[model samples]
Target: MPTVDAVVRCPIAPTFRVSQLAGMFDLPPEPHTERRFQVELPGLDQPWQVGLIVGPSGSGKTTVAAAAYGRRLRKRLRWRRDRAVVDGFDRRLSTRAITQALVACGLGSPPAWCRPYHTLSTGEQFRADLARGLVSPGKLLVLDEFTSVVDRPAARLACHAVRRALDRQTFAKRLIAVTCHEDVARWLRPDWVLRMPEGTLTRRCLRRPRLRLEIFRCRHDVWPLFAPHHYLTGKLNHAARCYAGLVDGELATFAATLNHFRPDRLRISRLVTLPKFQGVGLGGAMLDGMGSLLSEAGAESITINAGHPAVIGHCNRSAKWEFRRLYKTGRKPSGMYLQHPHWKTSAGRAVATFRWKFS
Candidate 1:
């Protein structure tokens, strides 16, 4: 623990009018003077995953971090304006590692990945910058102005996505997020927090609040909201039953299930979670809820086969989901097997089928 006692100050020449105003307001005679910070923040060189340095704007937050961290703090990252966002990651990293970093930082949409960084939405660019910063292997990664460019809800939601990303790491790595917004601290669930001005270090093992989603059958018109996030085509099946999962009255996930050749059988057509809620298994929750809805409506067998890596991982981890089979996407079945409807929707990639039931 480096008990920092740094003095933060800037030169000020109070004019006669300013001095008179200060005296009128009973303010300090020598205004805007230096202040000393004795922060007991520790564990920069130690083992940790995520930490935060947060306070109000102009509370000497950045000044304190610079005094303690120095060159380790990455204030800004330069991106190629002409290239796609996916291409902006460090060139030394493998494709898998790059994609993993993108997923971890909540930039999970492949379409957005292919677009130039400057063309993305503010929230999308924030996640992309975080992904680029985290893809490199290091013991410490310091980010300043964390979540400063987005709205309050988006900032909180992105924090959860970032938490999920850091939690997935099996290797040694850590992040120190510098921000002014305090609301995101709980959502980020940081291991430690260093409050500025006060210079207080509070070690915490905080957890983000549990979010429950209410599922409802929604109109197909709402698919436009989720289509941009999906990797597949934006088109939904004509007869597909659409459903939406909401958190706090906002749509967080969208899913579509189609009736198979047999009335009792069902196949999931599309399951998409908004980028803000990605990497937290809401997509799987949408699937589970849709299965229950169809089950009550006379669906005896609800089968799902998705191509997204996150979707596949979620299905494998869920007790309600069981592996049915795996087959090449380009393969064709002969005779009676050719009648299976699953082959019609997914092609050109390997697909794993799973059966869903309440656990």
Candidate 2:
């Protein structure tokens, strides 16, 4: 949710194994999870040299990367950028500290004035941001959501850059990546692989396996703004809860669920929210809160059917869902579920109905 922030301190013990790191972050240990459709990576390795993690959208891969990176932060660190003005703090320091921190992350020399952050390409920004983390003495490079938005070629190039950097380094520079695209694996050739499934982790050692992608449910208030048609299945539907995004009491998002209460679980007939607040983590918060609320009320899991792949992907990325049952919708379910200019379509299109379970 907080795009890999620069924190005050990373709590990694120098003696902890990679599996411990996985457990700390709630990832599946190695040798058990699949990658690249045929590999299983183990997690008991120590001082990991380099590894690539691949999974489908919303598979909690980034969360795993964050945990590993956090564990590697027990050493001194800094951040660097060649020509971009570094703003924000990893809770490390002011502007001056930022420049030095970049070097500590691995930059040899930083430009006097950093260019504006927006003008840079996503790949450059990613490398530059990572430079800050890399400079840390003995720091493990944790790259989260490594290639979600970049073009395929750029992702490959980025992977090459990282590999080159690690290969040339005289000393060990541990590298770990969390990505949804398996395309980059051939070049990365990670020493280990970790896969995150619905509510659990499967660790693999070396060989990647075919991933079974699934979807989950979340509520965003933007449904009225960008997905109104999807919400109204021929009728006005309310009763969804909403939230204010750090904007005291505005209800920036909302979610509605028609439930079939049972002894073991709660089957959701409907789940919807506004589109404006979809990707901003409000939806995740809503789903998490709702899941907890339902669980406390005697529900073992939450289940739903959704036609939107984006919804499923969001739920999957959340690491909160468990069981997923995909199903078809109307006889002639047109792809034209919701058409909006503001939303990005390259991620994927919505299905007729997505079945989800919460436990």
Candidate 3:
């Protein structure tokens, strides 16, 4: 149980206003010329994955963290303004490796990867920063002001994504998040917590709150709310049945099912999970639940076509879904194109098809 101590001193000019302000308010004058902080942290004897330094603002959290892990503490990241978000990563990291990090960190949209960091939303930028830093060779990462710039929901989901990513990685890495907001601790569920200013430390295994998503059939009017987040941007199909999944009264997933080739054969035509909620399996749940609905409604066959590797991988591992076929997407033969007569072409793309049934 090594203890770390930090002293913060601000040179005072001792002006007239300073002297008067000290007497009236906590203006830092007269008897109080310096602030001292003492923090006790666990030594390297035990294994730990995550740690949190949390308290109110100006509570000496940063000072304590810097004293303990100065080398890992970084105030800001320099992202290239002229480069895309994926291009801003280290040259040693392959595009696939960088995109994997981004996906694991909850910034999974392919379009966002091509856009510069400045063009991303605040939440997206936060995840991108995490992804870039997480791929580093360093064993330790010190994050200050964690999730401070994003909304509460984004903060919570980002915490979950970070926890999942760290747990899945092979590297024996550790992360220490320094933040003023204490709410994220619930989602983050760090291995230990150090409350600043007073320097209180607690070590315990904390469980993340289990989230339940209630999926239900919904009207297409809700599609607009989720349209922007979909990988393929398009209007909801009028002939398709739409379903919505809600978590704590907030919509988190969307799916549109259609017959496509035959009215009796069902297919999940469009599936989208809000980026923040992607890794949580909501999209797959929406697909399965909607497929079961149609199955119960007398549909003879059910299928799903997926292009994303993650989704395809999930379906491959699931017992409920069986691999069907792979489509070589491109401009089809003129004779074949005449049969479908689709306006847009998916040239040079590969899509995996799967059939859904009771496991």
Q: For candidate 2, what is the lDDT?
A: 0.47
The per-model lDDT (C-alpha) reads 0.80, 0.47, 0.80
Return the TM-score for candidate 2, rounded to 2 decimals. Answer: 0.34
Show how many residue pairs clash in every candidate, following the order shown: 0, 66, 1
TM-scores of all predicted structures: 0.87, 0.34, 0.87
lDDT of 3 by residue, 102-137 (tens): 877888677788899999888899998888888877
Select the stronger candidate by lDDT from 1 and 2. Answer: 1
**Could you tell me how far off, in angstroms, the CA of residue 275 lies in candidate 2 after the best superposition?**
35
lDDT string, candidate 2, 52-86, tens digits: 66677755455445443556522222334433446
Off by over 4 Å in 2: 1-47, 63-114, 170-172, 196-359
User: Which 10-residue window of candidate 2 scores lowest in summed lDDT?
Assistant: 1-10
Whole-model lDDT, candidate 1? 0.80
Residue 227, candidate 1: C-alpha displacement in angstroms: 1.8
